[model samples]
Target: MSKVLYIKANIKKEGESRTFKVADSFIEEYKKNNPEDEIVVLDLYKENIDFLRPEDLGGIFGPKDETSKHHPILKYAYQFADADKYIIAAPMWNLSIPAILKAYIDYISVTGITFKYTEKGPVGLLKNKKAVHIVSRGGEYNNTPYEMGDRYLRTILGFFGIQEVETIAIENVDVMGVDLEEKMEDGIKRAQLIAQKF
Candidate 1:
């Protein structure tokens, strides 16, 4: 069975977060469609995900000794690399993903684990993996320059050799006069459709 990694990067719970609402629908559909698949959930808010420190940098750049091999950060990278599929749920904060999510990305972006540098350039190691981003925005940002969250995710995931990436956005959430329920319903429908094939 394929392994699916579900990364939850929001402080708000599923009942209160618009992003989680749509992501929940997608995950539910995905589970129904692929009951044999394994799902691993990582809640950033509940986890002790911290920013990179001096020791972390040393461990990453230093020699591959026993301490480095057993470093706590490497577990995140190993788990990320082992997954066949990824689902990231977050809200747009200042036109980008949450800082904690970025920190998690930092943990997983390990050299020789996710990517490797060659004579030509840095090449991703994990190939044939798929990913999807479920994001909620206060305003419309898709297809616009202001949209950086999904764009950043697509770029970074591509860096890790995951080329097949899709995004389901719940937009205009805070816009005045917008039908929030309708937008949510539309996002749910799209999410469910993607989940069927994801």
Candidate 2:
């Protein structure tokens, strides 16, 4: 069975966050379609992920000794590399991803683990993996230039050798005159269809 990593980076709780609502539907449908698949949930807020510090640099750039291999930061990289699929849930903040989500990305973007330096430049090591991004935006930004959260995420995932990436965005949630429930239900329906084929 494939291992699916569900990475939740929203600051708000599930009940209050529109992002979580869409993500929850996707995951529920995913579980139903792929019952044998293993799903690992990593909530950034509850994980209390910390930003990279000066002391953490040594373990990241230094030799992969026993101690360095067991470093907390490297643990995230290992977990990420082992996953066959990924589901990223995050909300747009300031037209970009949350800081905590970026911090988690830093932890997983380890050299010689997720990617390696080569003569042609850096090459991703993890191949044949796929990812889906689930996001909620207050306003419409999917095709606009102001979009950054999902754009950046897709770039980073590509850097990790994940070429097949899908996105499910629930946008215009807070826009005036928008039917919030209707929009959310539409997102949920799309999520379910994607899950069935995922």
Candidate 3:
């Protein structure tokens, strides 16, 4: 079965989050279509994601080090390395991903595990994995400089060897004078379509 890692960053709208509804619909359809696929949902709000401290960095790179002392971070890296696919659902916060999501990225970006430095450049170790990102934005900023969340994810994940990335966005959800429900419904429909092929 394909191991799918789903990372959830937010569920509430007030917190610059309006993507959960669409993400939930996508996940439901994905489960229905790919029932055998394993979906591991890591909700940042409900879980304690490890922070990449100096000591944790040492544990990852140091030879003959006590890896058990850094079990949490090591586990996170292994989980990331084992995944065949990934789904990240997060709302745009100030033109960037949520802080919790970024923290999770740090925890998983381990040297010699996710990626390794080479003579020419850094090479990603988690080969052949694909990722889909679901993002929500408050205003109309599609294809603009303000759109950084999607690009950042693609860059970082690509650096770790997952170059095949797809982004599904629910934009303009919080724009003033917009029909919130209708916009959301449209986003949900789009997400559902994406799920069918996901």
Candidate 4:
């Protein structure tokens, strides 16, 4: 069966941020069609993925030392490599993703694990995977060249050998004098449609 890793990076766990709700719509549709597919939800807010220590760095570069076993950095890399597909959801912060999401990427981007260096150039180690980046932006700029959230996400996933990457963005989150109900409905509708095809 296929395995999908749903990475939820919403620092706002169950509040005004609509990124999680958007991601859930996609997952709901996907689950309807592929009931047997395993869904692994990585809630970064609730997890304990610490940074690398001096001892852990030595073990990562060389043989497994006493400190490597408990390294918070290694688990994310293993989980990232194991997934056949990925669904990442994050809200736009300052025209980009939040720091928690960036930290998650940092934890998983281990050298010689997710990617490797070759004689010709660098090559990604993980293979045959697809990724969907779901971003929530506060303003509408779909056609503009300044859409940093989706672009940066696609680029980073591509660097990890995930070529089949797609994005579903919900913009205009903070438009002037707009009805909150209508905005949410529009976002949910768009998200549901993308979920059907995703």
Candidate 5:
């Protein structure tokens, strides 16, 4: 049974966050598909970590010992580095992810732990892991540069040696004349398919 880390980055309630609901649908199907797998959920809103604070340096310097580590940088980094798979669910705010989600990323992107620089260049430590991003966007920007959330997540995960990354995007959700329910259903349906194959 593999360990799957589910990161919920939205502040909205369970049913209010489109991305969260889609991810939950995906997890529901994932659990059905892989009954033995372990799923861990980390809600960013309730998680208090000063990710933007410059004084917190455990992530960059790497934890010296678990006994001495008192901050969330090592805690979040270890959780991420130890996971076999990841599920990041969030919505695009101002053409990017919410600040809390970005902060969570900062907490997890630990140097010499998640990734390291060698003579050849930076190398990802956990090459065997996989990741999936379930995001909801108000506008359509799937293949465009405006999709900063997807692009940044892909890049950072790739930097950590997770080469297998998938995205389930619910685009044109608000601005376009598309029905929210229909778009959400389609996203959930797609998530089910990915869950089976993942």
Candidate 6:
């Protein structure tokens, strides 16, 4: 069965977040299309992920220090290594990704774990995976100067060996206000259709 790992960065559950509805819609359709696949959802808002420490950096460099073996960093590295595909859902914050998503990336982006440097240069260890990013923005920002979140996300994921990344952005969310009802409907339909294709 295909394994899909979903990482959610939205802090709010439902009413507080306008972007969460879009993520829910995409996940519903994705699950419907690929019923046989295993979907693992990680709500970053709820999870207690360890922050990067100096020891974590030491562990990545093949630390001969025996204490590093029992570090929580190894568990994170293993979780990332096990995923076959990735789905990240978040709201654009300050023209960049949410802090939770950034924290998750920092946790898994270990030197020897996700990638390594050979004489030839840096090489990604994680392989054969694709990523789908669901981004919700308050303003219309795609292909604009403000669209740094998607570019940064894609670049970081690519560095981990997940080259094929598709982003579905729901823009003008906050700007639309109560008129957002129609926009949400349209965004859900578009995201669902894309998930079906994915």
Task: Evaluate all candidate structures by whole-model CA lDDT and list the values in order.
Answer: 0.92, 0.91, 0.83, 0.78, 0.86, 0.80
Per-residue CA lDDT of model 4 for 1-198, tens digit only, reads 888999987767475568887788789888987898999999888885455567766545654344544666776777788889999988888877777788778777777778877898788877778988887788886767777777788887888888988778777878888676677777677777766666
- Residue 149 CA error for candidate 6 (Å)? 1.0
Pick the lDDT winner: 1
Could you tell me which residue pairs clash in candidate 5? none
CA deviation > 4 Å runs, candidate 1: 63-70
The sequence of per-residue lDDT tens digits that candidate 1 reaches over residues 1-198 is 899999999988569999999999999999999999999999988888999988788767655544554678877887898899999998999999999999999999888889989999999999999999999999989899999989999999999999999999888999999999999999999999999999
Model 3: lDDT of residue 107: 76
Model 4 root mean square deviation, Cα atoms:
2.6
Compared with the true structure, what per-residue lDDT tens digits does model 2 show for residues 80-153? Answer: 99899999999899999999999999999989889999999989987899999999899989899999889999
User: Per-residue alpha-carbon lDDT of model 6 for 135-161, expressed as tens digits?
Assistant: 888888998987898999899888888
Clashing pairs in 3: none
Summarize candidate 3's per-residue lDDT along 36-136 as a digit string, tens digits: 99999888777777567787776666652446334766777778888899989988999999888898888777777789989988999978889889988
Give per-candidate clash totals: 0, 0, 0, 0, 0, 0
The best candidate by TM-score is 2
lDDT of 5 at 78: 77
- Model 1 clash pairs are none
What digit string (tens of lDDT, one per residue) describes model 5 on residues 49-118? 4556666764457445665245556778778888999999988988888899888888777776688878
Candidate 5 Cα outliers beyond 4 Å, as residue runs: 68-70
**Candidates sorted on TM-score, descending:** 2, 1, 5, 3, 6, 4
- Please identify model 3 stretches exceeding 4 Å from their true place: 11-17, 64-70
Residue 186 lDDT (model 6): 85
